[model samples]
Target: MLQIDRWKRILIIGLCVIGLAYAMPNLFYKRVEAHNDAVAAVEKAGGAATPEQEAAIALWPNWLPSSLVNLGLDLRGGAHLLAEVQVEQVYKARMDALWPELRRVLADQRSTIGAIRRVDAPDGQLRIEIENADQMSVAVQAARGLAVPVATLTGAGQDDLDVSAQGNTLTVQLSEAEKALTDDRTILQSLEIVRRRVDEVGTREPTIMRQGADRILIQVPGIGSAAELKALIGTTAQLTFNPVISTGSSADATPGIGEIILPSQEQPGLYYTLEATPVVTGEELTNAVPSTDQNGAPSVDFRFNPTGARKFGEYTSANVGQPFAIVLDNEVISAPVIRQAITTGSGQISGSMDYESANQLAVLLRAGALPAELTFLEERTIGPELGQDSIDAGRIAAAVGFVAVIFLMVASYGLFGVFASIALAVNMGLIFGILSAIGATLTLPGIAGIVLTIGMAVDANVLVFERIREELRTAKGPARAIDKGYQNAMSAIVDANITTLIIAAILFVLGSGPVKGFAVTLSIGIVTSVFTALWVTRLMTVTWFERRRPRTIEV
Candidate 1:
């Protein structure tokens, strides 16, 4: 028993020492670069740099660790937004895909389904009007298998011969299977696109996650306002080359007019014609950077591929002094009059763009564009003020708690309490070391988890002492009682700690951000505390007894 106790103490202390060494980086210098940057930015802003600013500036070392794994939005001052993806758009895409098939089906079985007419509704809604009541019923029945779980059949009015409505207003409802297919594809595509775009923007610790049904949650730390986020995700980013149509007032308005028509890829009924030929297409874009023109006005300078350059030169050379429209996603962004041919592969986009707008456009162009529009559904940001307060409060609370726990243990158990306190200190060190090693963010809730572990850390000691007391009452020798105490209490200790660990695991899986942090610390604490209390303290006690060979074991 004495030997076991001695070994346990040695292991616990050694591990704690190793942990402290590993985590020493965190204790001394955590956010050197960020602090220095903050100070520099403040100085640049013409604000008076105070002593605290100077101290922060002095504290930051270039070689030190960065400000990663810091507190979250609740601790920091930031904006939170909830944006939802437009699911109806996914449905529309599916319908557009089925357009050719539907047309084919209708032509084959003309008697089965009635004449089909496409109708455009408000807010991008499309409807397929089914003509003739009896024929419509036949068509609806025929389309049942295509779009499963069709809604209740709507009857045509007595006077009205046209089929008023069916499920989805297309004489067929989209099946659960169809919706699932469309939803999955849309979400998967949107997520990937959003991630790529955000990553390009270079926001620190950006979080773009999918939510319920058709929603995406985006969280960008240190980016307080989401005006930038909105600009990035809200755009469908559909880039196309379109010719400018002449207003017929002047020859310059012709913009190298052309008459080529391109059919819409997504929609059969939709077709676009270029009144003037595009000098260059977005596909040729290589890079775009925000820069100031000769007049010091903000603009986006873009470079194109060799093919685009050749085409641009040809188009401009043929039609000098004509206005060429720079179209983006079907909207004319700029209509610059061509003074000369741009033979080089580079072009400048000058519009009514302010400095910020120009910079944002440059960022977007650089990041590439999303294939589809993504609506944000949920967001949460940690505020810097809240984070600082949490850190201060957590530090104080932990300090006071540790001191109280130490006093209580020593006061209650005398010599045994001293042993427990040593083990407790080691437990704290191990937890911190592990957290630092894993680069775990210490949240406010996580601090609470650590405090909770403090109380529970003494549990094993309580059990051992009680068992020793019982053994003493039974007239067992000092060494014999100590051995029996550990032997008897081992089963109870394992069962109780294991149950707590299980609960912690469940909490981690089910809970959200902060909750998960709390669960993590709590779970880790339970394991470390058990190890320290059961082994470290026991070993120390055994070593002391074996060395001193005291005849009397003080209760």
Candidate 2:
């Protein structure tokens, strides 16, 4: 180990330089973070960077990597929320939607099932009573014909809807297979929408994940409280194009068989009777972005997929001069008469929107509608002062641990102990460098892992140095003793590190939140300590031996 090759020397020095380069950003943490945030903001707006932000970014060179360590919620003081998606709401919605389709289909064959009437039913069931008793079989067969295959791995080959008939009354509900598919969609869509809404605020390292069948876990670092998060994701933005049947202020205005009355969201006491079946929904949108309308007012520009575009174009051409209500979450956003057909797939939404509200609406539309409303099951707030207290405590613990380890190592083996202490310091720098590079979140538990690492980092050096002393007692020369010490201790060092690595991997896979964070720092520290001990310290000693050629060494 004392005999170092020229290639190994270059490699070791190069790694040290690279590690320091990455670690340098954390020293100027606030400045680098502001620069990154400004860059992200400018890119999001599709605008040029301001002079101030550009100057801040220029403080750090462009050639060097810019990633910094991401602080966890406990460190940064942010919002935490556990929201449960009301999947049952989607079931009722599905049934309500089925009423119109069932009415239309059974109406086409009016002679068979005469005077079909929707009666009272349970939450997720559609109950239709036919005037003709013997036509129950005919109604069941028609409803069953509307069934489609479930589109999930577990639900494939099963019908999406179940239809049953008894004593002239027909009942329809989602099959078990359809409920499974709907639950999956609800949770996944909720997760994505929550993530998009948080990201639009330009916050960093927000954790949004699915917890169970209908629950989502959201932890956003740097936001003030759970109420702010709720406000961000509260809007549904479920836009639709429904043909207008009538306009009135009467909230109780009963409608025709194919019509429903809904009040406008912005306008109080204004009701609109619109066709139950929509021309298209927000789901068909391919893109939506904040923009300026022709009148220079803030608006949202949207583009539809090919299918939606085709349907919209045909509908507009067939029903020229007719009014269509632009509904959002069962409320009318606008109802304008169609003067001419819009052949293009793209259009803009203008409703006296200010810049901020327009941008928020655009983000919600881009994220797509959540499958169902979410109930806030849990909420929390972490103050920055509390985070600072924890940080200060952690720093004190680390400093005391470092000093104790350094003093003990120096007292034990003099020059060799000093060498080990130097390697240990470099080992820590490497750990920070790796964590920054991987964008790992640093929590309080993570700090404890690093302190633990400081205590354990010198084990390899200790084993090697003790073996060197044993060799010296056997009458071997200093150079030969050092070489023998490193070679003989290699097996124990490798075995110990490998075993620890296996445990860290298990913790990372099985544990949650802070536990995973601890595993990350511990794993990174182990790899770095092994490199510093086996290569870095050995290189230092070999260079010293080559230059001084000492006849007798204290180590």
Query: What are the models' TM-scores?
Result: 0.66, 0.93
Per-residue CA lDDT of candidate 1, range 1-555, in tens?
446644555666678777766555555544544474566667665987777677777665545433334444554444455666666665554455455556666666676565676655442233566666456655655444243332233321211111235643553334454455556667777777677767665454454666677777666655656675676666765444445444332222322212333333333443444542344556577788899887898988998778877887788888788776666665556666789877887888766679987887776666555545565555555567776787788889988999999998899889988999999888887887787667676667889999999989999988988888888777557888887888899999999999999999999998876788899899989998888877878878887888988776866
lDDT of 2 by residue, 1-555 (tens): 468879989999899788878888888888888878777777876978889878877877778778898988888888898988989988987897788788889887679879888877787898888889787888888998899998888887899999998897889999999998888888887888888888877788888888777888888888988898888886777888999988898988778655789997667888999887788889899999899988898889999999989988999999999997888888897888999998798888888569998888888888888778888999999988888888889889999999999999999989888889999989988888888998989999999999989987999898889888888877568998889889988999999999999999999998878888999999998999899999998988888889999998887
List ranges where model 1 is wrong by over 4 Å. 4-14, 29-69, 93-176, 188-208, 226-238, 243-331, 335-358, 365-383, 472-480
Give stretches of model 2 more than 4 Å off. Answer: 41-47, 97-115, 151-153, 252-259, 293-296
User: Mind sharing the TM-score for model 2?
Assistant: 0.93
Q: Return the lDDT, model 1, position 411.
A: 92
Error of 2 at 438 (Å): 1.7
lDDT of 1: 0.67
**After superposition on all CA atoms, how large is the RMSD of candidate 1?**
9.7
Score residue 504 of candidate 1 by CA lDDT.
95
> Total clashing residue pairs per candidate?
20, 0
Candidate 2 colliding pairs: none
